[model samples]
Target: MKEIYLIRICGKCKKTNILINEEVEDTIKKGYYISCSHCGSKRIFKENETSDLRKCMDNNVYKRVKGKIRQVHSI
Candidate 1:
């Protein structure tokens, strides 16, 4: 299977390259938004939406397989 990488979208530039999930939450505190590395959009980390997302995988849409991940590698 092909390898897939994950990234959050840039609201301004609309670039979906790489993702860093709330990496700056500690420093920024509760009332702050993370900036996109490419376009500096301040909405990259939408806490409410991303809260229910699984950290092991990137996208919100996923399948509940009984065995291993269907097309994933390295667990």
Candidate 2:
């Protein structure tokens, strides 16, 4: 059976990282690399990567799409 992985889009890079489990899902952490959608820069999220990501939906930090493919978001 194909496992469905929950992914969180990186606000900085817009790169989607498959959420391993509830750890990353419940609370948002920083230090992970997310690819930028513009310059293709592998950027790191601050402490509020989770919250920041949610804000990105409106603030335009990042956008979510229906696929697993990685979309690079640049500054």
Candidate 3:
């Protein structure tokens, strides 16, 4: 099966932070801190965060299908 991933969209500056399946699992396991590199918004990875991540992934898929992939700065 293909690996799944998520990209977190920063609420403040609308930047994206990519999180692989492994990373997402680790975050959920360890309860690690996640921050947006562009906007510096911080949050803990938990159940709610996972749902938000799913939403972000879904939005990305929708944008991709519509041929509207966003461009972000190099990290």
RMSD to true structure for each model, in Å: 11.2, 9.3, 7.5
Off by over 4 Å in 2: 1-4, 23-75
Worst 10 residues of 3 by lDDT: 44-53
lDDT of 3 by residue, 1-75 (tens): 644555666666665666666776787689776777666887423222343445544433323435765543424
**Predictions in order: lDDT:** 0.47, 0.43, 0.56
- The candidate scoring highest on lDDT is 3
Better of 1 and 2 by TM-score: 1
| Candidate 1 lowest-lDDT run of ten | 45-54
Using TM-score as the measure, which candidate wins?
A: 3
Task: Give the poorly placed runs of model 3, Cα more than 4 Å off.
Answer: 1-3, 43-75
Candidate 3: lDDT of 59?
35
Q: What would the TM-scores of all predictions be?
A: 0.35, 0.26, 0.46
Clashing pairs in 2: 13-35, 36-72, 36-73, 36-74, 37-72, 37-73, 37-74, 38-73, 38-74, 39-74
**Candidate 3 C-alpha RMSD relative to the actual structure:** 7.5
| Cα shift from native, residue 62, model 3 (Å) | 18
Per-residue lDDT of 1-75 in model 1, one digit per residue for the tens? Answer: 321323455677654434334444444687665577766777663322234225534543345589644423222
